[model samples]
Target: MYYDLMQTGLVGELLITGDNDGLKKVCLIKGKNDFIIPSDWIRDEVLFSDVKEQLGQYFKGNLKEFDIRLTPEGTCFQKLVWDALTEIPLGTTVTYADIAKMIGRPKAERAVGGAIGANPILIIIPCHRVIGSSGKLTGFSSGLENKVLLLEHEGMEIKGSERSALVM
Candidate 1:
């Protein structure tokens, strides 16, 4: 059976879901109706204790990498993109094209973007670390503001009058 938990975070409220195997989702709740929890899911704080703790440490700048096992659901290509995202160093950012190359599909930047957009486990998967080719902040499932916050929290400088450019 799937278990879930609600935890307040830096970006917003996070809905964490998983089972005994590993975590399945770590979605940011933007509004009341942003996500619908499955009826079969049960609320279990005990199951997500480690997740909460690690996330708290990450937000406080005490942790750089997560040790939790994740089992996000997605197509094989999407999983490949997400795996590459995990390889991104904590304080560095890469373009979508970089991810495409990392997965051996150097010409599939747009496809990589789509897969990155579909990532279910946000911070843990490190999708926020992907930027545009011009070093500009790009789309993030949680929004660009949160993306900047995360990057800055990791010690990356964000420049540009619109707060859309990265100094990497």
Candidate 2:
């Protein structure tokens, strides 16, 4: 059976969904269009106690890495990209090209960006750590504002400029 819960954290309200297999999604709810709970899923805060606590620690800047089990569904290439995303250390950012090279697809930078954009599990998976080769922030599924927030929360500096409004 799938279970889900809502937890308000540093970024905003998060809609977390999963089952016994593991967490399937942890999405930041920005608006009504951001998430919709399935009719068959049960809302059970008790099932997500650990996720809540860990996220709380993260927002508090007391946690750097996540140990939660995950079961994100995606294509094989996307999975490869997501898996590489998890290896990104805290307080550091990399480019899509870096991720492409990390996965042995040195020429698949664009494809890597597409996979990164498709990442379903956000903060825990650390998709927010990706930046442009020029050290500018790029697309984040939760929006660049939240991306800047997450990166800033991790102690990275975000500078603004006319050329690249958000440079890391």
Candidate 3:
């Protein structure tokens, strides 16, 4: 689990070392702004390169789905939660508690939130789509503002009660 710290063409970027596939996935959320990714986790490769190119296109409203594979690390329950995240449609959204129930860990809503927060792959894992049970966006290791922007970029309606509104 490593990430490269680089500000490519996006607001903020993270290049994650694919632990399972050797295929790094670059994450560009919230139009690419405001974050902290462990710089020591970087592995130099063209995987992240392709990911960056596609992410740029995706953010610019030119591309929809990303053709990237991920090998994010986590617990069995967490993996279940993250996998559920990937099933979320490109432009749709889901909540942490919702994810909890979906993974058959209904009482683990808080646990689900924990796993969502622990998500290492960001965009590809779709952690940004997991909002608060109240329909409010919350707790992205990448930041809440970035979460909102990602939702909007995916054409979400902002849920009306959104707080920061892209606090960049």
TM-score versus the correct structure, for each prediction: 0.92, 0.92, 0.74
Q: Name every residue pair that clashes in candidate 3.
A: 2-41, 3-41, 11-32, 12-32
Write model 1 residue lDDT over 1-168, tens digit each, in one string.
565555555688888888888998898889889877778778998988999898988988998889999898899999899889989989998899889999999999999999999999989999989888988888887888888888888999889743567656
Clashes of 3: 4
Worst 10-residue lDDT window for candidate 1 reads 1-10
Which scores greater on TM-score, model 1 or model 3? Answer: 1
Tell me the lDDT of model 3 at 29. 44
Query: Sorted by lDDT, highest first, which candidate order results?
Result: 1, 2, 3
To one decimal, what is the Cα RMSD in angstroms of model 2 from the true structure?
1.8
Q: Cα deviation of 127 in candidate 2 (Å)?
A: 0.8
Best by lDDT: 1
Tell me the lDDT of candidate 2. Answer: 0.85
- Rate residue 108 of model 3 by lDDT: 85
State the local distance difference test value for candidate 1: 0.86
For 48-99, candidate 2 gives per-residue lDDT tens digits of: 8898889888888899899999899999999999999999999998889999
Cα error of candidate 3 at position 29, Å: 11
Clashes of each: 0, 0, 4
Error of 3 at 19 (Å): 5.8
Better of 1 and 3 by lDDT: 1
lDDT values for all models? 0.86, 0.85, 0.66
